[model samples]
Target chain A: MTEVKKTYKHYVDGKFVRSESGKVYAIDLKNEKYEIPLTSKKDLRDAVTSSKAGFTKWNSLTMYNKSQILYRLSEMIEGNKESYIILLQDHGLRKNEAKNDIENSINTIIWYAGLVDKWEQLTGNLNPVAGEYFNISHQEPIGVTFTLNSNSISLDDLVKSFLPALTVGCSVINFSEKNAVIALKLSEDINNSDFPAGSLNIIAGKFENIVEDVGGHVEIKHAAIYDDISKESKTIIGEKGSESVKRISFQPPTSGLSSILPFIETKTVWHPKGK
Target chain B: MNNWEYAESIESEKIVKIEKKYGHFINGEFVSPNSKKYLDTISPSSEEVLSSISIGNEKDVDFAVNAAKEGLKQWSKTSPSERSKYLFKLARLIQERSREFAVLESLDGGKPIKESRDFDLPQVAQNFFYYAGWADKIDLAWGSEISKPYGVVGQIIPWNFPLLMLSWKVAPALATGNTVVLKPAETTPLTALLFAELCDEVGLPKGVFNLITGDGTTGSELVNHKDIKKIAFTGSTSVGKYIQKSLAGRDVGLTLELGGKAANIVYNDAALDEAVEGVVNGIFFNQGHVCCAGSRLLVQEDIHDIFISKLEKRMQTLRVGNPLDKNTDIGAINSKDQLDKITNLVNEGVSDGGELFQIECELPKNGFWFKPSLFTGVQANYKIATEEIFGPVLTTLTFRTPDEAVEIANNTEYGLSAGIWTEKGSKILWTADRLDAGVIWANTFNKFDPASPFGGYKESGFGREGGRHGLLSYIKASS
Candidate 1:
C-alpha cells in the first residue's frame, strides 16, 4: 500500500485554500516534500479583510470563553500529538526531539490559555491620579495583527509567533516561510479548536513577497516580525508603515509579559467622583 | 438681550527676567551657536520680539549630542536615589519660581495667564515631582530588566506647552538614566531656556539635560544623529511621520505624541448645562492647541438643537484678549502662521456648506487671534471635520444611536483623546469601551495628571507620556 502525499494550502478564515495567484513553493524534507501556497500581495489583502471581521468576532467573546477556547487547542493538540510528532519527524527532527517540541508547544498553549483572562491584571492598574477622580489605565487589542514567524523549524517557535497576540484578543495573520510544514500541521489542531473563523489565519509565503503589502495595509493595525530580516526590508517596512502610523515591532519578546505589550494600546479612562 | 463685558485684571510680568539674547544650553552652560545665526522670538500677543535665540545648525546639534553622550557617562554613574534627589530639588525650584515661569510662558507662548499659572505651571511641577519618586522605585514599577535606559535621548516638544512638555520629556529621561538633548519649539523657547537655568541651579550633571533652541532643521539634525538612542517628539502628525520615516532602518527608539481629532460625545441623557460647559472646555481649552483636544462634538440627534443653542451662548461669554489678563478665557494664536492656518480652515468649512457660528468678540489689534468657532450641518467627510484644525474651532455631527455614535466617533484616523458625557454609568462604560481613543474623559474634559497615562491610538501616534507607563517611553526591556 502506498501512502498519500499531502499538499498544504494556506489556512485562512478557518478554510484551507490556495492563494489567488495559484503559486506554491516546495519544502523538501527528510521523508516527504510538501508544497505550500505562496501568499501574494492580493492574498495578504484578503487575509487582512478576514482578520478585521475575525477580530470583532474573536474579541467580542468573553475572556473566560477565550481562555477555554485556547485551552481546547491544547486538548486537540494533546489528542493529536503522535501526528504532529510524525510531521516533525518528516521535517527532519529526531523522534525524541519531535516529542519535546510538541510538549513545549502544548505547555506554551496552556500558559497562554491561563493568561488570557489575567494579562490585564498584570499589565493594567487603577491610576492613583492626584485628584478627586476615578482614573484607571487599561489596554485594548490592536486589531488585525500580522506576525511573521521566525524561520526556526520548530512547532514551539512557530506557536510563539501568534500566541502572544492571540492570547490578548488580537486577530493574528501568522505568516510562515520554510516552517510552513509545522505551522500548516498545527493549523489542523487550530481549526479543530473553537476559534473564530479568521482570528488565527496561517498563511505560507516568503515574507519578501508581501512585506510592502503588510506595511502599507492600513487595516492591519500592527506588523510584528519575529524573523530576522535584512536592513533593506526593515527600511521598507518602516517607511511604508509610517504612512498610516502603523505599529511595527522588530524581533519582539516571545515568552514574557513584554511579548504581548507591543500588540496592545493602553487606554486610560477618567471620571469625576462625586455624589 | 444682555450686553456683558469682562474687566481686564492683568497679571504682572515683573517677576520674570528675560534676556535680550539667548544661546544653546549644552554641557550645563549657555554657549553661542557655532552657526552664528539667531532668530527673533516674538510675543504673539503684542507682536513684539521677546528675544533673539540661536538658530542651531548641524554643528550646534552635534555639539549638544556629544555633550549628552558625555553627560550619559555621569548620569549612568549617579545613584538612583541621588537622581531622585536632583529631580525633587528641580520640582521644588519649579514650584518656587512657578509664577515667574508662568508669566514668561504667557509672554512667549500666548496662552492665557489663567491657564499658564494655574494649570500648566502646577502640572509641570507635579510631573517633575511624580517622576522624582519613580526614579528609585523604577525596579518596582516594572521588573529591573525593563528599566534600563536607552542612553542618549533627543526630545522635541511643541509650542503649546513649553515647560510642561519639558517636564514630560526630561523628568523621565533623567529618572530612567538617559541623558537628553532637547529642542524647544521655535515660537516658544523662552520658558524652556528659563528651565535650563533651573537645571543648572539644581546642579544636575552636565549633558544630562541639554537645550538647543532652533527651527525644524535643528530637530531634523537631532533625529538623524547616529549617537542618539531615542527620539521623543510631541507635535503635528505630519512631522511625526517625517521623523518616523527618517529613523527607518536605524536601531533607535521613538515615542510620538502627535495630532488628534477627538470626539466629545454628548448623549441625550447628559445634563444639558454641564455638557455645554464640557463641550466648550473640550475644544476651546488652550485655543484648541492641545493634541488631545476634543475637536469634534458628536451630539445625540434628539438633543442637537438645544445643545447647539446652549453651546453658542456659552461660547459667546468666553473672554478673548491679552494672555497677561487673568480674566481672559482665550488668548492670542500661538503665531501669525497658526492664526492664518485657523482662518483658512474656518473659511474652508463655510465653503464646504457647513453652517458656521463664531462668537462676537473684540480681538486685540496687534495680535493674532481667532474667535471661538462652531460648525453645524457638518458632513463627516468635510475637510474641517476630518482634518485637525488645531484651533478654537468645533465641528458638530449628529448621531441617532449609541452604536452610530461610537461608529462616528471612531471613524477618524486619530484616536488621541475623547470625551463621553452621560449621566448613566453603563452608557459611559459602553461608549468608552467602544471608542478607540487613548484617553477617555467621562463627564470632564481636558483634565491632566502626571499619574494618568496619555498618548494616542492610530495615526495620532504611539507610546504614552504620563504615569507608570511614561517611564516605558524612556526605557527598554533588557530582553
Candidate 2:
C-alpha cells in the first residue's frame, strides 16, 4: 500500500494556502524531499494588506486575551511535539537533538507567552522631570512587522524570529527560506493556536525573489532581519526604506527586554498640575 | 485701539568676542580647512556678517572623523568617573558663562534673548549636568546587557536651536564614551564654535570633540564618512531622509529629530483662558521654528468661535522685533530663506481660501520678519493646515468628538508631538492614548527636561534624544 503524502503550503491570514504565484521550491531532507510554496511579491502585498488589518484587530483585543492566545500557541506546539521532533529529524537532526530543539522551541514560546502582557512595563517609564507637571513616557507598538528568520534548520531560530515582535502587539509576517520545511510544517500548530487572522503569517520562499518588495512596502512599518543577508540586500532595504523612514533592524536581540525594544515607539504625555 | 508697547531693553552683545574668521576645531585646536572656502556666518536679525566660518569639504570632514577615531582610544581608556568629572566641570563653566553664550546664541541664531538666556542656556547646562551623572551609572540605567559605545559619532544640528541642539547631541555622545565630529548649521555656527572652546577649556582629551562648520554638503560628508559609527541629526525631514539614504547598507546608527506639524487640540471643557495662552505660546515660541511646535489647532466645534476670538486677542499682544531686546515676544525670522518659505505657504493658504489674520505690527526695515499670522475656516487639505509652516503661522480646524479629534490630529505622516487640553483627567488619558504622537501635552505645551525622552512616531523620525532612553542612540548592545 502507498503512504499518504502531506502537502506543504504557505500559512497566511490564518489559513493554509498555496502562494498566489503557484511557484514551488524543493528542499531535500535527509531521507525525503518536499516542494513548498515560494512566496511572490504579490503574495507579500496580500500578506501586508492582511497584516495591516490584523494589526488593528489584534492590537484592539484585551492584553489578557492576546497573552492567552500566545500561551495557547505553546500548548498547541506541546501537543504536537512528537511531530515537530520527527520533522526536525527529517531536516537532518538526530532523534535526541531533534527532541532537545523542540523542547527549547517550546520553552521559547512560553517565555514570549509570559512576556506578551508585560513587556511594556520593562520598556517604558514615568520620566521624572523637575516640574509641577505629570509627565510620563510610555510606549506603543510599531505596526505590521516583517521578520526574516535565520536559514538554520533549527525550530528554535524560527520561533525567535517572530516571537519578540508578536509579544509586543505587532502583527508579524514571518518569512523563511532554507528553513521553510520546518517553518511551513510548524504553521499547522500556529493555525491551531487561534491567532487573529492576519496577526501572525508564516510564508516560505526564496528571499531574493521578494527582497525589494519587502523594503518598499510602506505598510510593513518595520523590517527585521535575523539572517545574514548579503550587503547588497541590506543596502537595498535601507535605501528603499529611507523613503518612508521605516524602522529596520538587523540581528536585534533575541531575548530579554532589549529584544522587544525595536518594535516600540516611546510616547511621553505631560499634564500640568494646577487646580 | 493702540496696542500696549513696552520700552526696548536690548541685551548687551559685549560679553561675547567674535572672531573675524574661524576655522574648524579639530584635535582640541583650530585648524584651517583644506578646502580654503568659507561661508560668512551672519546675525540673522541685523543681516550683519558676524564671522566667516570655514566650509568643511569631504577632506575636512575626513580630518574631523579621523581625529574622532584617534580620540576614541583615549576616550575608551578614560575611567567612567573621570569622564563624569569632565562633563561636570563643563557644565559648571557653562553656568558661569551663561550670559556670554546667551548673547552669542541670540546674535547667531536670531532667537529672543529672553529665550536664549532663560531657556536655551539653562537647558544646555542642565543637559550636560544630567548626562554627566549618567556617565558612570549607565549600567544601572538600562542593564549590563553590553551597552557599549559606537566608537565615533557624527552629529548634525539645525539652525533653530543651535547651541542647545549641540548640547542635546554632544553631551550624551561623550557621556556614552563615544568621540564626536559635530557640524552646526551654517546660519548659526557661532555658539557651537564657542562650545568647542569650552571643550578645550575643560582639558578634555584632544580629538574627543571635533567641530566642522559648513553647509549641507559638509553634513553629507560627515554622514558618509567611513569612520563615523553613528549619526544624530536634528533637521528637516527631507534632509533627514537624505542622510538616511546616504548611510544605506552601512553599519552606522542614526537618530533623527525631524519635522512635525503637531496638533494642539482644545476641548470645550478646557479652561478657555489658559488654553488660549498655551495655544499662543505653542506656536509663537521661537517664531514657530520649533520642530515639535503645535502648528495645527484642533478646537472643539461648539467653542471654536470663542476660542478664536480669545486666541487672536492674545496674539495681538505679542511684541515682535530684535532678538537682543529683553521684552521681545517674537524675534526676527531665522533667515530670508525661512521667511520666504513661511510667506509662500501662508500665501498658498490664503489662495486656498482659509481666513488669514495677521497681528497689527510695523515692519523692521533691516532684517527678515513676519507678523504672527492665524488662519481660520481651514480644511485639512490646505498647505497651511497640513505642512509644517515652521514659523509663527497657526492653522485652525474644528472637530466635534474626541474620536474625530484623534482622527484629525493623526491624519498627518508626522507624529513628533501633540497637545491636548481638557478638564477631565480620564478624557485627557483617552485622547492621549489614541493620538499617534510621541509627546502629548495635557493642559500644557512646549515643556522639556533632561530626564524626559523625546522623539517621534512614523515619518516624523525615530530615536529619543533625552533621558535614559537617549543612551541607546549612542550605544549598541552586543550579544
Q: Which candidate is the best by DockQ?
A: 2
Worst 10 residues of 2 chain B by lDDT: B1-10
Q: What residue pairs are clashing in model 1?
A: none
Error of 1 at B95 (Å): 0.2
Worst ten-residue run, lDDT, model 1 chain B? B1-10
TM per candidate comes to 0.98, 0.98
lDDT by residue (tens digit), candidate 1, B249-341: 889999999999999999999988989999999999999899998899999999999999999999999999999999898998999999999
DockQ of 1: 0.83
> How many backbone collisions does model 2 have?
0
**Residue B274 error for model 1, in Å?**
0.7
Among these predicted structures, which one has the highest lDDT?
A: 1
**Which RMSD values do the candidates have, in order?**
1.7, 1.6
What lDDT does model 2 reach?
0.91
- Tell me how each candidate scores on DockQ against the true complex: 0.83, 0.86
Q: Residue B452, candidate 2: how far off, in angstroms?
A: 0.5
List, residue by residue over B371-433, the lDDT tens digit for candidate 2: 999999999998898899999999999999999999999999899999999898899999999
TM-score of chain A, every prediction, order shown: 0.97, 0.97
